[model samples]
Target: MKAIREARGIGLRRLAEAIGIDPGYLSRIENGQQGAGNGTLHRYAEELNVPIKAITHEETPRDQE
Candidate 1:
């Protein structure tokens, strides 16, 4: 997610504003400290020009097993 964002040259503030979220909240989501709701996820995917799967496929600690 962060990789794609950086590759697209999208700033945190820009993406957050596009997705109607707080920049700090978006940072938390990027850091895995918070989860984004489905609608929010869709907005982010659209803003980043990526599929929802790209953002949703994050490997949680449990998924490592």
Candidate 2:
């Protein structure tokens, strides 16, 4: 996520404004402090021109092995 954002040269504030979310919220997301819903995930995928799967992925439990 940070890679995509930085690749586009967009700041957190700009992305938050474009997505109609709070910059603080975006900051939390970027820092792995919070999770985003499907809608928010799609919005970011659209804005970044990246696949939604790239931004939102399922976390495999350690016990799966």
Candidate 3:
């Protein structure tokens, strides 16, 4: 998440404001100490200009085949 944010040239405070979260909370999210619900994931994707999968780790059935 932090990588994507940095790659997009987005500052912590800027993204936090855009996503309606605190900068410290955003940092925690990026650090993997916290988890985001589906809605928050959408907001993060929208604010970071990335797909939700970019920050999530869901296993697809294809990988098990």
**C-alpha lDDT values of all predictions:** 0.90, 0.86, 0.85
Off by over 4 Å in 3: 59-65
Model 1 CA deviation exceeding 4 Å by range: 58-65
Across 10-53, the per-residue lDDT of candidate 1 in tens digits comes to: 99999999999999999999888998899999999999888777
Q: List the residue pairs that clash in candidate 1.
A: none
Q: How do all models score by TM-score?
A: 0.84, 0.82, 0.83
Worst 10 residues of 1 by lDDT: 54-63
RMSD of model 3 against the true structure: 1.8
Worst 10 residues of 3 by lDDT: 55-64
| Candidate 2 residue lDDT tens string, 35-55 | 988888889889999877788
Prediction RMSDs, each to the true structure = 4.7, 4.2, 1.8
- Candidate 2 vs candidate 3: the lDDT winner is 2
